[model samples]
Target: MTAQANYNYSYDLNNNIFYSGERQIPAYELEENEIGTCEKCQSTILSLSYHEIDDEFIVTGKCSICGNISANIYGHEWNWISEIFISHFFGQTPAQTTEDSELQIPEARKSLKNEDNGIDDLELLNSIPMNQIETIFSPTEIKAMFARAKGEKCVRQYLYNARKKYKTFEDVFGIKIDI
Candidate 1:
């Protein structure tokens, strides 16, 4: 009879690694002829998997000697390899930069602000990060806010029509122009 070797696998979330007992055996290490090397132990086998969550791309794996390790490329730091991987694997276009989609305020919108109140919805939206803005505003409302901030014509009428099906601009966008 022939003997067999069995092994169990454990995953580390903070540092994505596959380990048995205390020894790390990342998938890359098992490759017949891999060129990548581990930075910690200088082992020529560190398996890595790419994951794009929200706004960050995380590469996780382990080394034979280092239990768990990972690297993160976030925001605009993504290189060509990461871009291609994220686009082809995740099927998502790279996220837009903060300045790329910023709302443009027209002089007309500036003149129409309630003279009694100095609140500018556009100004407020600009101050907060996009993540926070997304939490409180729906896509449609956000689009309308951009229009209103830019002093687009007929924004009041458009908002009036939208109010019937959705929350008021003040309630959704977290800025009170009338107050």
Candidate 2:
């Protein structure tokens, strides 16, 4: 079986949501300000498919006028839950970082405040030597490390769910992740 098949997740094209068993997970959508332009014929309509394991999106635009097909692959750092939840559901605008000041939403502002006060848990875990990681960090922190390594944002819900797989991570990595 493919590695992606091991994950019990599927996307609903009609509703634009992801499902892991019965759990409804957020899915990415084209932003109001964003436009999909077909390179070949300049068409505006496009069909997109997201590949979760690779964190890549395949965009296809078929021009009705010119009968030209345009396809592209977008990769790197794009996530469904984090992006959709913050941008769509919460109706929060993306933060803009400028030379003098950075404008962030309330949630991001809170996280920034916390980071300013002390080292982030994820950062600390990443800095620790691999040989000493299991010894230095707690099981939860270790799980967060694994999730981060897998390209997930270290959000609380993701971290909490990941912590339960501490044993699995330990077995795979041959490290004794402790509480």
**lDDT per residue as tens, model 2, 1-179:** 11221233333433444444345544454332222553434656434333332465533323334322222345555322221111111111223221222222111211111243142233223322344455444666666655564456666765565567657755553323322
Candidate 2 wrongly placed segments (more than 4 Å): 1-35, 79-179
Taking all chains together, each candidate's TM-score versus the true structure is 0.27, 0.21
Instruction: Estimate candidate 1's alpha-carbon lDDT, on a 0 to 1 scale.
Output: 0.37
Clashing pairs in 2: none
- Residue-pair clashes per candidate: 0, 0
lDDT, candidate 1, at 96:
17
Residue 52 local lDDT, model 2: 35
In model 2, the Cα lDDT at residue 138 comes to: 66
**Residue 5 displacement in candidate 2 (angstroms):** 28
lDDT, candidates in the order shown: 0.37, 0.37
Candidate RMSDs in order: 18.5, 16.9
Question: Model 2 lDDT vs. the true structure?
Answer: 0.37
Q: Which stretches of candidate 1 lie over 4 Å from their true place?
A: 1-117, 154-179
